[model samples]
Target: MSFRFLPDDPVASIKLRPGQTVMVDPSARRGGSCLEVLEGVARVYCPCEETEGMTLAFLQEGDQVRTDRLCSEGICVEALTPLSFRSDAEPQEGVGFDSVNEWTLQLLRIRHLGNAELRLHALLALLVNRLGRRCGQWCDLPFRITHDRIGELIGSTRVTSTRLISKLRNSDQLDTPSGDNNLRLSAALIESAPVLG
Candidate 1:
């Protein structure tokens, strides 16, 4: 849960190791400044005292998070993989898409599902579709998220998420091998997610 404050000076780029978090203070930047991911993946989350660590979005290479539109307290970006991003990007014209907003909307939708299992399934499908890639027979997510974080994402308790994850493992739908940082999900499991239908 430890995090460092983003430097107020405008730097060309910043890099972070996996699990490192830096808080972005919108008030410290220009009106339309943005951060453009140069490489790797990051989990963007709330930094406000009330909602600290609540993930708002996941950004990967080429994705951008607009500072002007963030909460007054700004947000925190946690390196999910070896991450690098430009800190002094100008706002692009005519690109109405906001990765944070889109992810927030989708996450909200998943939370509204009736059952925790459904929510977990939908969450996996969404993550795989948005941030993972198909391998020979499984979809591989570049980074691993903890069960507690998964529970937070799906609006469930950690114990419930662990139970559901165990079920998936027993069914051969999920694989997290020791010594590997990736999460391998069966293609069938991703395809069968009701949220994707």
Candidate 2:
């Protein structure tokens, strides 16, 4: 057993016996996860499924998964790969983590800039940046969780969320998928849409 922990450059290399399951605790609160396939495949379970059915997110060697920040686990996950996790998480922030670093503070400054276009564009960029993904120029985004849900996350609303996102789509800033099932968003659409208000 020759193992070591590396924080500066995180890595995981392990050979778990077949059928071995470690760290299977729900109270094991999670922040976020990104995975890379090394030797096998894995399934990420939807954490929020009521006892109905467990939803799975399949990942291959070249795929990455980002779970939401608040967790009681609507996304339940299981290893299809002989799992190796390279995790980066700080201890729980009792009052949130603004003081983590200068960049965090720099982010806050954008909120206070007082210029509408700059402020809105910056915030829009941040919104898409933080909650967006780009795979070959298209972004697979989170969609249709209700405008109120959007408001709950950013102090806006179901109507406001629908309106702003709608405006983005109309102005060509963002695109929302047609049905509730295909909420995956697109970044290229955002790019295709000029950045003018």
Candidate 3:
């Protein structure tokens, strides 16, 4: 399903099932309006015809997307997990931070790493650092992203991503349980990543 921010409503809360998308039309949104993630995770992407579906960032609870900064074609937010967000947040003055921009910069840095393996390691470390939590022996991410998405983030082919992931599994650095949608990475692996250091 899809939703558009309506100017008539000063505030609105929307919930979406996994894989569903919502379009935030800048023209329809009130000035200074923002979208704040309330629960779960979302993948924010470009919705313009020329760059449609280009992944911009991932947002989790408390993250906000400032509509005023959106391009003319606006953006699309896809539910990566059960997602809920508010559409009419009061704009903050001088907050001086954009999560989307920060994520983009980090992903760019990962892409510039010398090798695919280092890039992948850095990407995983970045995700886990920003979105996962340590649980005893492992750092657990709440949701699993497909190898294709991982490949895109790390500037590699899906086959390469799969191969790298397989190697991590073999080395006991990563775990994906058959019935679970979460991913677990060894603490040692995360700690060893030079990107975040």
Candidate 4:
């Protein structure tokens, strides 16, 4: 029987059995691709010569990003780990891409611009709410990212992303715990920033 994959179900094609791992290839575009669960579980990795081996996004069973492309700039995606899954079953529902594609488009707009303006943060905050995985109050994801990748994806460099994150934090626009690799943002934090408009 075909498995009916739900919206936001445990991302399959991963969480495999013991000693199994799949080598997910680089996505044609960022954020979304048809991953092959050849071994165990997989994480999205972005290839950055500088960061060594860091990721920029993460997906569990049933997770898909940018299935729809809303921007002119193509999405950048790579696998973080070798993963595996049961590929025998067929999905009842077609892989949905609406929400993620919308988020990608909005983020593309933010990156294309030079600064992380207020309205931009507003949208990003929403996108984060919808796209990010929640660990208690903190929303997190593995964005195997680098300075250059951030700049390219958001139309800026690692330095720019870092500065913006710092600025947002200093202004109480975000909350990323000290020494944590990911940035966690709340609605209030993002909204507090001065509107770029």
Candidate 5:
């Protein structure tokens, strides 16, 4: 079942309970490797050259990342939910890399080049498009995203992200259902952000 994410490829799968973390360090001597989240959400953090520090990229079920060459710095992936994952030493073929790479690149571009508001908007739209599940006219973003995580995604301070989120809520662009960590994004809000469409 877990091997479905890396179909037709030799792989090893493991289960990670919530809050577990795995380090992926590829070496030429051991060949390349790929990591795929078969279930649950995982946060992948890598060293960012531009930021001169670390940056986070969140992955949901069916998403995978790989390094064909040696990873000098390596990547740290932490499970946000009870996660099933796999690691492959043999080169992967036909895996879902295009969408994952595009998504990562787009966020990096926004983080590096976009204004605070634009970055915030782009990140929200991305969440809706990538991790959201449709619920009526709203899309449910099933994550407990703190202002700090939002700030990390947008390259801003937590205060700034809090202000933006407050503004969004006041403007009726974002909403949270009572007693749930999941966020509900209005369809109108999704349409308004060009990044989301």
Candidate 6:
């Protein structure tokens, strides 16, 4: 397998202080170039068909975010903390970038899942698989994500997300260990999420 990472010679490099936002237009991706995070956290807002407006994803270091039609009407990348990133405005073939492609495809699949609540569960499961830290059959998602953030990501209202989160928590599929804001996900429960009816 062959792949190309984002260009080292980025068209632009920017530093954002916490709470700042950058709006990226489709024109910025004219050459197939995209944005890659170098440090800190970015909260991405991309419009989705299932959304009345946009959906959100909290990306951390090494996350690649598309600046193309995948975010029709463009997208916003907000700095949750101090952030540094680069954009490769000039397109390059992603020859061996299977991970990036797979990441995008997985999100797309989650966005199009037939069941809304199932989609949310699946998204959490996917996140666990991609980003969780293993601990004796449990996976810790080392990110501070609130029910409101979950709502934004899954295209539901805050109240709804909060309720759903409580339900999932009660069901033993997800947990928050004492003194830790990070979510702990059950590996067995994540595997069983898809078949949940």
Candidate maximizing TM-score: 1
Per-residue lDDT tens digits of candidate 4, residues 25-112? Answer: 2222233333323442243333334544333343444444433232232222333333344332333246554434444455545554
Tell me the lDDT of model 6 at 156.
66
lDDT of 2 at 170: 72
Rank candidates, TM-score, best first: 1, 3, 5, 6, 4, 2
Mind giving the per-residue lDDT tens digits that candidate 1 earns over 105-180?
9999999899999999999999999999999789999999999999999999999999999999999999998999
lDDT, each prediction: 0.91, 0.40, 0.84, 0.42, 0.68, 0.66
> How well does candidate 3 score on lDDT at residue 60?
95
lDDT by residue (tens digit), candidate 5, 141-175: 87667788788788999999999999989988789
Candidate 3 per-residue lDDT, tens place, 1-197, comes to 25554344656788888888878778877777788999999988887667536678889998888888888988888888899888877765677888888877777788899989999898888888998999998999888988988887888899999999999999999999889878999999998896543
Which candidate number maximizes lDDT? 1
> Which parts of model 4 have CA positions greater than 4 angstroms off?
1-60, 64-89, 92-106, 112-127, 133-147, 179-182, 191-197
Error of 1 at 89 (Å): 0.9
TM-scores of all predicted structures: 0.96, 0.33, 0.90, 0.47, 0.77, 0.65
| Candidate 1 Cα RMSD (Å) | 1.2
Looking at model 6, residue 52 earns an lDDT score of 40
Cα lDDT of model 6 by residue, 1-197, tens digit? 11122233455677887667766766535545678787876766654445543445667777776565445566677776678888863334564653345655666677677756877888788777766667887887765576776675666678888788888789887888887657888878677667322
Minimum summed lDDT over a 10-residue window in model 4 is located at 1-10
Runs in model 3 lying further than 4 Å from the true structure: 1-11, 49-52
lDDT score, residue 23, model 6?
A: 68
